[model samples]
Target chain A: MCQLLALSCAEPTDVSFSLTGFAARGGLTDHHVDGWGVAFYEDRACRVFVDEKPAYRSPVAEFLKSYPIKSRNVVAHIRKATQGGARVENCHPFMRELRGQQWVFAHNGDLQPLGDANEPEHGPYAPVGTTDSEAAFCFIMNRLYAHFAAQAEMHADVDDIDAVFEIIEQATRTLNPYGIFNFVLSNGTAQFAYCSTRLSYVIRHWPFSSARLVDGDLSVDFAERGTPADRTAVIATTPLTDEVWTACEPGDLLMFRSGALLRRAHVPVPDAVLATSKYALSELSAVPA
Target chain B: MCQLLALSCAEPTDVSFSLTGFAARGGLTDHHVDGWGVAFYEDRACRVFVDEKPAYRSPVAEFLKSYPIKSRNVVAHIRKATQGGARVENCHPFMRELRGQQWVFAHNGDLQPLGDANEPEHGPYAPVGTTDSEAAFCFIMNRLYAHFAAQAEMHADVDDIDAVFEIIEQATRTLNPYGIFNFVLSNGTAQFAYCSTRLSYVIRHWPFSSARLVDGDLSVDFAERGTPADRTAVIATTPLTDEVWTACEPGDLLMFRSGALLRRAHVPVPDAVLATSKYALSELSAVPA
Candidate 1:
């Protein structure tokens, strides 16, 4: 499985502290170390750094640790390579442009046979890498494009946030039956996260307290580092900090905008769907020694 | 206006030497200091470093200068911002995914009102930035997509390099009628350069010689640095080094692959096209103080 880290904030925030702990999992702590990538969204554009090297050892990651590139929306991933080879093209988070907005996505867990079946049917948005994660992202993008195209034909303004969330929630539900499908997606303005097997998040706001990393001994006092108006939501496959991180129920789709959770859809995983998730069953049996 | 720098090589090579001098033009040497960006292609993926800050002073650029990230294809740009605002989104070179390959582009001259007219008619590919350069890129991409789509419908293989060049040459010629449209573009494997006003290039092979930067007091002994197998083609809006450089004639489109010139098309500039190029006229008058 891979690990994902994402941040959404009311004000632009630096992710160095959180990224330090998360990146350690690539090689120093846990064993996801196939490759890694990180993206920082600034307005409508994003700057992405990806390397086919362990995040814990990459010089680029080291520079990022100290550079403190600030952004309101950030998504990062460290891969274990469940479905793709260890190449730069296979690194997450993958990015593509749709409707003049750059969209970024990072996925954890394997979709396997489901992705292979669905990918060939998708068009206009196609995978550039031989990864199940990229195929899933392309599938999602293709669905969104088709939905918007149909709406445009009817001369309808499809910018409704609720409608967008509905479509995303539906797509997530459909993919959940395939395998563990935890992912974070953003369009620079809003963040959407879906939990399949494991995911957690924490919101830091006024009167912030000191937080310590779970993967490392590093600590930071947000009260001293942040402004009173600063509000941030950080989501990770596993909690990066020893803070009050709330675990999302399986099949929960959460939407965040301007640092606040604006909407959520709880589409509980059915027993039949869970039974068909062969990759998740294999994951259970293949637990690290 | 902007400054364009690109390198295509037979083997993966680091661009620290040439980029050092080219980046200095962002502030220390010349006055195109609005923003800067550089992209290095690794296999099918690319790592791009962009900052709204001047390259001479940006910490990111400093890291790049010290970090010898190697690649077979590289493109860099320093923007003067004749059209768009000095924002991260407006920074060149802009990137977009096309045909499972990331395309990088940077323009050195303005297209003005013509871009505004042609952009709306283009579909599927659209510019995220308000810059004429991006509009031109989107227009070109849209045209390529349309051409390839038509070819696919006709059951024709669209991988013909000659046919691809023909289409690109046609697009470049059409844009030249608008204004001075000098640009460099690449899709990782090949580099395409078009010169409407000013551009120069140099190819270094087996008998490598010592070279000195024209913008800075830096020199490098290529003989000591390169191997017999190292063949590199460097293209820039202005000659980056104190060496024998071939200036591209007006309306010349050159294609370079594996460090060798693959094709060249000479479509001489028309007097009417030159007379209407107001930005080129202003550029001639504003010759750096």
Candidate 2:
């Protein structure tokens, strides 16, 4: 239905050729064209681009083919909307800030029981558009403010990253009432990913090899620019083709940092919301199409 | 500074177990707590949840560990703010609307060139916050509207996916003068990713093996649920530990759909901007904080 791409490496590396091929799948070579976006990380920074237009026709896509914005971390998406509008604000690859760092995310499906727009004026972080994704983000930030307040009182350094992940994972389940809940998230130094219904991954380390793009007639030899110490990981909804991929198990959420898997596990499932869509009126429908 | 996790597969799969460990890395067992979000995709729909709270102490994160939201595609993030204040408005994985779809996005790192609150409506999309990332998103949307207007006479299926990518890619390069621009984006069906610095990937299919997380002591035997017919890919800033990873080349732009790479290339860097930060500053400074 949609496509997702990401990179995690021990050392900084560029993903020009592979991404070009992947972007085309949105509407160029394939027909997933609803919207598209891409993000790259340098040190503790991120560069992102998004458009409601098709990738192939956009001059930005053409420019990407020639410019190589190298990075050790990256995330990208091409969309085909089913629930919301087809505008740029509804595009994927949303970003925010927390604890003095930037965070990035993208999604490839629909969500139900999205809470009402409880956009709290909680300081700096705020939504620029309307979407369940933004609402959820705002909700999280509001809760975080409360938590930080608590932390300040406790004088506890919430640096045990695992503790943070646990909090986020748990909060997400509470926000939604129906359907699937899978996602990819990251900061500059580390990254985290989870699979609910569909997800895949591939990693390239010491013995680099040549890889050809399945969509476009392009290939890259990792053996040339990459070194033995350079370790990397790529994740997506489906295999990027031309490369091997690994599937995530049901109820599995994973984390990554410095080009390696930081942790993983099988967790419990959230309560399912009863299906009322069949009877819900158009105005009351989950998606006001 | 932050952590990211994602899942892309051919069918529905739970992400709790894997996420449990990864969640812990963000201030639980490790320390990436600024905020977090996750989304699960089923066919053409998605279930998303986001929390500005640390993944560690939030009851929401705990609930997620117990709940199993499944989907085919997913994206998640844990933040350490690098731009806006640690408020809900500045959270990563911002969302909005365009045309007729819901789009999601998240980012890692920082940038300048933000939206001008005083001016308000730039074109189509508008920023609710001061982050450069949001402004860039609005700019892209405005451009799309303008381009579509210019091509209104032709009214071609103009869904040329590449065209969209080309435009966004160029916008990204132009926005680069502010700061790092790394991020992830999605809109229901496909996902697109790009790198300026820090990005990598790892993919697995058919013979999916076991993978361990680096941030925590957890692992998943993907072979348990995977079938030979299934193919998937995972992309992230760093490998989730057990998998191999590949890096994106400098200035490279990419596209992805249905879990496959379709088009790819390095975006051309303009010599004028390359000559000095003055251009970047000028363009970025135009944006209101």
Candidate 3:
């Protein structure tokens, strides 16, 4: 498995502190050395940066650690490469535009091979890379697009974003027969997360306190960063800080909008399916050598 | 009009030298001072960086100047907002995915309003921002996708990329009714440039000589940076160097692939339409004080 980190805030906020700790997982504190990517959302647009180099070693990542690019929503991933090579295309997160809104996605788990092609061919979802994560994102996007097209109401029903949210919950269930599919997707307005194997999150709001990094020595007091009016939700494969994190069970699909926990839809996939995950392969990787 | 720059090379080459001079135009040597963007392509996937801030002041642009991010295809734009607000989404070098390949476009001119909506609504082709440039891009994409769908051969006909090339050429002709439409489009393999007003290019090959930047004091001996086997084509809104640049007349659609001139298709539009352009607004803007 790789590292997944996402943040949704009430206001445009910087992710430099959390990014510092999250980036450490790439060849610093952990062994996810394939590549890393980050997306910072600005309304309907997002600026995405991806590198084939390890996050801890990438100059882009280093610049991000100091650059205060304020955004209401952010998603970052450090990849270990389960299905694709360590190329720039294979790096997470992937970006696509459907119906004017730009979407970004990052995955941290394996799947039981969609088998569109043994070669790196983009069959239906149109993923340029060989990663199953991108395929899964496109699968959900196709489902959303088809949902509107089947109704012969591609334009009329688009304002109903809640419809898309339910479709995502349903699509995650359809993909359950694969393997661990923990991934985070965002559309600038909100962040959607599905927990298939391991995921945790912490919501910070009024009366915030200082939090120390779990992966590094850096500490940031929320009081110094902002007033109590600010709110945010930080999600990751594991807790990135020493703050209290709520561990999500398998098959939990959550939505965070404007730094608030909008809702949660638990896709009840059986626990037995997690048995087929690429646990053996991930465990065999050399850690912090 | 804004400045546009593109590079197509036989090998992965960095644009540090050209970018350094180009970045100077944003709030510096000359006044475009809206925003700037760059897309470095690695096959179908590209790493795009855009800042709503002026390029000369943007830290991201500063980093790109020192960083050697090499790619076979690169496209960049320094914007002078003609239709949309100065925002990242409205930044040049907008990207969209079609057939799994990322297509990036940067336009230097305006168009007669494609009046689908009075507001910033994504009508028909689905542009998230209120820019005529994006609408034009989406319109072309729709025509291309419709061409495949109309034939009932969406998947099968994709292998014939030459068909897509011809379609793009024809589409450029169709868009000439719109006002000044100088733009560059790339899909990692090649660069397609359509010059509506002012544009020029230089092809560098073996036995390269020194060239001096017109916007800056720096000079570079390309022979030191490249070998006899290296070949590249650098296109810009105006010649960026003191070297000989073949000025492209209006209606010139040129293609450069793997450092070689593939073909040039001149889409002749009546010269009288340039009178209707937003030339007054551009000239009225304050230049370098």
Candidate 4:
């Protein structure tokens, strides 16, 4: 239904090179051309650029290509409009502020029934756009807020990372039954990715080598561009560079902080859900190009 | 401490002409060189450009000057950073989402003790930056959410405009005692402006005349650019154009919807507070150049 890209780094780094190749998929190399968006975090604050235009031809995207806005965390998306109109509001990554922090999310797959069935209860978080992806994000945020509220009522601190991870994992597992639900989320400090069927990531560190884009005639030598202490990771629906990309399994949830993988959990898909997944696969395979 | 600019219009209009003159104040004309930001709303969605660099010299601002991104509501700020560091996080205008709508705010005055004294209690909204402006915004949002929650619990619809206006007015009155508190706020549909000491506005409609920038060598004939149906209202800390501008009185709050003034109120300022306001005026007058 769409494509997602994300980067997390130990130091603030520019993503122009990677973004150039990724943006090609917006209309040049692929057909996710309905709209596109990108968000970059500078410390605890974020700057977001979104356009209801093909990223490959958007003036804003072109400016960003030459302008080096460095960030520690970045999330981007190219939409094919599986369920929503091709309006500016339907563009990702969608952002909402929670617990005094801004959280950004981008989705790459469809979750059909979740859009209507999982109606968000009266809560502070709500979806402004009519997309299954945004509904899912709002649902997750509402759950997180509820969890925090419960913890606060008990007079306990809500910074327990383990507990938060468990809640997110449970929510992702519950939504996976509806359909493919691959997504990336961040709160300026850490990034979380959940793979339902298709996702890959690559980590780069010292002793880096040059890499070429798989889709475009572009290449960058990491050794020339980064310092010896630099560490970075890029995540995408499909690998953008000719590098070692690790394929995430069907139900893998990965947590990353400071460019390093912090945790991984393999949540098994239910047998009944797996049996009906052929329809989901066909739905994804039918993405327009 | 900062300069604020906003536009509300019946039609989607480009603000490049006014923005050119306003941006000059960032470094070229006056000195609000700490940072600058602008937000444009497209329906319920928004695109914002912010830079820690001075606006007059920032490549991002230069790109914006030529890019024709049309919006019905827009807010811009050039910061002098009276209370916060010159970082991206401290830049205005700040944004948060509530009730599925994005709310943007920019402040042009100081609230000295309020920044530290009014530590936000545990709430759904909180400041991500260490600025008095952001703290004030959070305080307002928290109050709005509380009012909405109470209304919901009582089985009342939360869209009563009068009630919402009263709540906002009361909040602004409460903050005015802390220090100078001029601000502009919008939720993509309507705009709210409050003037503690200095602000001005101009309404342009049919039979529009030529206008010249006060801060730069630029002029525009609105009659040549806009249709007879076009109506626009521009608000700024100081008049941007050499036209008949209406000065907003001290403690004046104006609400605008669809480029027309919808409501106005003059909350009384305390005599003691007014006596201490001379220092605030001098601080603003001393803005570096």
Q: Which candidate is the best by TM-score?
A: 4
Whole-structure CA lDDT of model 3: 0.81
Instruction: Identify the runs in model 2 with alpha carbons over 4 angstroms from their true place.
Output: A121-126, A153-159, A268-289, B1-289
* Predicted candidate 4 versus true structure: per-residue lDDT over A1-289, tens digit per residue: 6888999899999888889988888888887889999999998888888888999999889989889788999999999887889988899999987766788999977776564444334467777778888888887887788787767656543356666677789888778777678899988878899888778899999888998888788889998877877889899887888898998987899988778888999877666655655565554433221
Candidate No. with top DockQ: 4
iRMS per model in Å:
2.3, 15.1, 4.0, 1.8
Candidate 3 per-residue C-alpha lDDT over A220-252 given as tens digits, one digit per residue, 9 for 90 to 100: 998776777799999998888888899998889
lDDT of 3 by residue, B1-289 (tens): 6889999999888778888888988778777888999999987679899998999999999888878788899999998888889988999898876667778899888788866532223222468777889888887776665576565443546446567677788888777787788899887787889888777899999888998887788999998878877999999987788888898978898888888888888788656556655463345333221
True contacts kept of each: 0.40, 0.00, 0.46, 0.65
Highest lDDT against the true fold, candidate: 4
- Model 1 lDDT per residue over B195-228, tens place: 8888899998987899998878889999997888
What residue runs in model 1 are displaced by over 4 Å at the alpha carbon? A113-121, A153-159, A225-228, A267-289, B114-121, B153-158, B268-273, B276-289
Candidate 2 lDDT over residue span B48-94, tens digit each: 55555787775556666765766556677777765665554455566
Task: Compute each candidate's TM-score over C-alphas.
Answer: 0.92, 0.48, 0.93, 0.94
Model 1 chain B is weakest, by summed lDDT over 10 consecutive residues, at B280-289
Q: How do the residues A206-261 of candidate 2 rate in per-residue lDDT, one tens digit apiece?
A: 78889777677777888888787898888877666577778887467788776788
**Model 4 pairs in collision:** none
Query: In candidate 3, how many Å is residue A163 off?
Result: 0.6
- What is the fnat of candidate 2? 0.00
